[model samples]
Target: MIIGVVLLLVFFLVNISIGSVYIPIPQLIHGLLGADLDKASWETILFLYRIPKAITAVLVGISLSVSGLQMQTFFRNPLAGPYVLGISSGAGLGVAIMIMGGSALGITFSSSSNYMTWGIWGIIISGSLGAILVLLLMSLTAWKIKDSMTLLIIGLMFGSASGAVVSVLSYFGNAEDLKLFTIWSMGSLGGISGTQLEILSIICFIGIIPVIALLKSYNAMLMGERYATSMGVNIKSLRWAMILSTGLLAGSATAFCGPIAFIGIAVPHLARMIFRTGDHRILFPASALIGSCFLLISDAISQIPGSAETLPINVITSLFGAPLVIWLILKRNLSSEF
Candidate 1:
């Protein structure tokens, strides 16, 4: 626990300090303490850009890691993740509809008007709702059918169908809306603000509460659903809770941070390697911390200078995450035994 906290603080500080302007340590400390300095451009850069980006990275990390862990256990698959199962895609479809489709419908939302962007919230909710719908269908199939792989295929098919719908919506959308969607699809840590950050924190906390509360149950579930059921785990209720939790974490992260990738699929493996244990009590927190650290590092790398400009976060993440994923697959460590 102590190491986790220390690593988190160090990574967060690194994220806040290594941006383009490179504010000195003293000014960064002063700005954080609410001190009244000359308000230099570097200080502004630290406060306005890096701080929010750091916060977004940490929150997104925790959200994705927890969601991934839950999905892995729920589906009884080692390779399960938010994106692998199409939860992120589902959420993306939701946001694409709201931002791109809303403009197509002639809805005008501004930064100042809270009511106008309820449609954005609607998109997020619908995305989560769409995931829940798939989960329900999977639950039904699980009872009548026996193949977990079949359920996974259904999830992928549902996600692909949703993506197709989004493509159709984009076809009819105006050029400006298409551009907005494209930028959003590229993903970033710059989109969240203090107020939105608070809301995101609350949503994630609520989402993971059940996981924390059911840590012991999760341990049992990790052993296998049959064992968990034998140990008095309420399989039905637990499935529902996990689906909702996965939705909240993945949906909220996608809503705010624009569909980050790789952390979910990779962080749990890091946690397992660190602790050498499959126990949820340790795995949960360790995965969250490692996920945050990994994303903070990725976000820092995205701020590389001497280029034409900072790369899109998605591009930087793919560079790191995709190779790791490929390696994991080639090594065959993604099997259920792990």
Candidate 2:
């Protein structure tokens, strides 16, 4: 745990310091302390852009990783995740509606108008509602069905349905609106403003409470539903709590940073490999720290280090995570650790 935390901090500082224009440690400290620097641009870049982006990377990492851990524990399926379960697709649908649907109806949503202040809230609320809606449906299905594999199939169906709807909306949308949604879907950590970062932080914090509270329940559920029920775990209530927590975490990340892929699925397994345990008490914090570090590293790489041009965050993460997913599938041993 201590090692994970230390790495997370180190990478976070590296993320903040090693942008296009590298700021040395002494100058970085001076700028952070509000001391006048040789270049005013250094202070502006450090304070206004890099800091918030780094913070966003941290929150995104922690939220997605922890949420993935919860899903893997609750569903007891190696392939299950926010994207697989349709939560991200649902959030993407909400964003599509807000951007494409609103534009179709002659409504303007941008940072230039008076509605600018409320725009982020609108996206976040719509995304959360969309994710919760899918989660509730999945919960209902889980209640009626006793098979985890069945629930996994149902979740994939939901993702497909939502994706179709989004595609239709995109077809009817204007070129400019399509471009905006396209950029958002690519997933950029650098796009979050200071105000949006505050909102994302608060939502992620609230989302994590339910995760922390259910650590014991998660450990119980790991042994299978029958065993968990034998141990007096309220399986139904636990399902609701997890779905709600995941909705807030995954949905808010999608709303602010677009639908990030693979981290939610890959990070828990990475944590397990690092920690060498199945205990939720240990896995939770380990996943959070490792997830943050991984995303920070991805963010740093995406910046192209020393270049003004940058790659999309999703591209970097997918490059790292996609092969792991393939390996897991080929190995067919997702349940080995559990």
Candidate 3:
């Protein structure tokens, strides 16, 4: 965990230094410290752009990784995650409704290309509601079904249903709305600044508190429900606690940055691989740090390190994260980890 935190701080600095004009370590630190820098533009770039983007990457990393860890623990399935279990898709559905279908329903937010351009809270609220709706349904389903695979399939069904709704909305949307939604879907960590950054920080902070509180419960849940019950763990309350945490974490990520793929499912396994343990007390913080580093790495690569042109952050995550996860699964037999 100490190593992970140190690595995260290193990556945060590295990511801030890597944009169109590479700011060397000295200049980056000087600018961040409010000291006079060689280039005036460097300060503007650091304060206005790179800093917020880097912070967003960290928040996203923490949110997705921690939430993913909780889901894996609760489901007792290595493959389960917020995205895998349809939480992100549900959040995406809510954003989709606001972006593509809202005008149809008399909602009058801006159609600007900027992500959630009209306001900060609108997308966050919609996305949270959407994610909570799906989680509520999944909780109800889990009560009737103890089989993890069965629950996973039901989650996939919910994802498919949400995707179908999004498609229908897209089909009817005009060219402008379609284009805006398209950009939003291709997640970018840029343009989250000012009040947006603070609000996102608050959202993620709220989500993480429960994870910290439930550490002991998560460790017990690993042995099995009957064992956990015998240990005096309230399985029902524990399940809902995880649900609340995951909804805020995953929902906020999707709302603020769009649909980020692979990190949620991949990071917990990565934590387990590094630590070689299923203990949430160890895994949770490790996953958060590693996930932040992973996304910051992704963000750096998306900037391409030098050129002004940038790739979509979502594309970078999928391109790198998918193959990494596949190799991990095949090499380690990830199912055994959980």
Best by lDDT: 3
| Displacement of the residue 113 alpha carbon in candidate 2, Å | 7.4
TM-score of each: 0.84, 0.89, 0.90
Clashes of 2: 0
Better of 1 and 3 by TM-score: 3
RMSD from true fold, candidate 1: 3.8
Please, what are the lDDT tens digits per residue for candidate 3 over residues 31-61? 7677898988888898999999999999999
lDDT of 1 by residue, 14-79 (tens): 778776566666666777898855556766677667887898888889999988887787777777
The model with the greater TM-score, 1 or 2, is 2
Better candidate by TM-score, 2 or 3: 3
Q: Model 1, which residues run further than 4 Å from truth? A: 37-39, 106-151, 306-308, 325-337
Question: Evaluated with TM-score, which candidate comes out highest?
Answer: 3
| lDDT tens per residue, model 2, 1-338 | 88777888789788898878988877777777779978889888988899999999999998899989998888887667767678889888988888788877887553257247655577667777777788778778878976766777888899999999999999998887788778778898885777788989999999999888989989999898889999999887887787778878988888778888779988898777667799999999998998889889999998888898888899999997788656864665556775
Estimate the lDDT of model 3. 0.84
Worst 10 residues of 2 by lDDT: 109-118
Q: lDDT of each structure?
A: 0.75, 0.83, 0.84
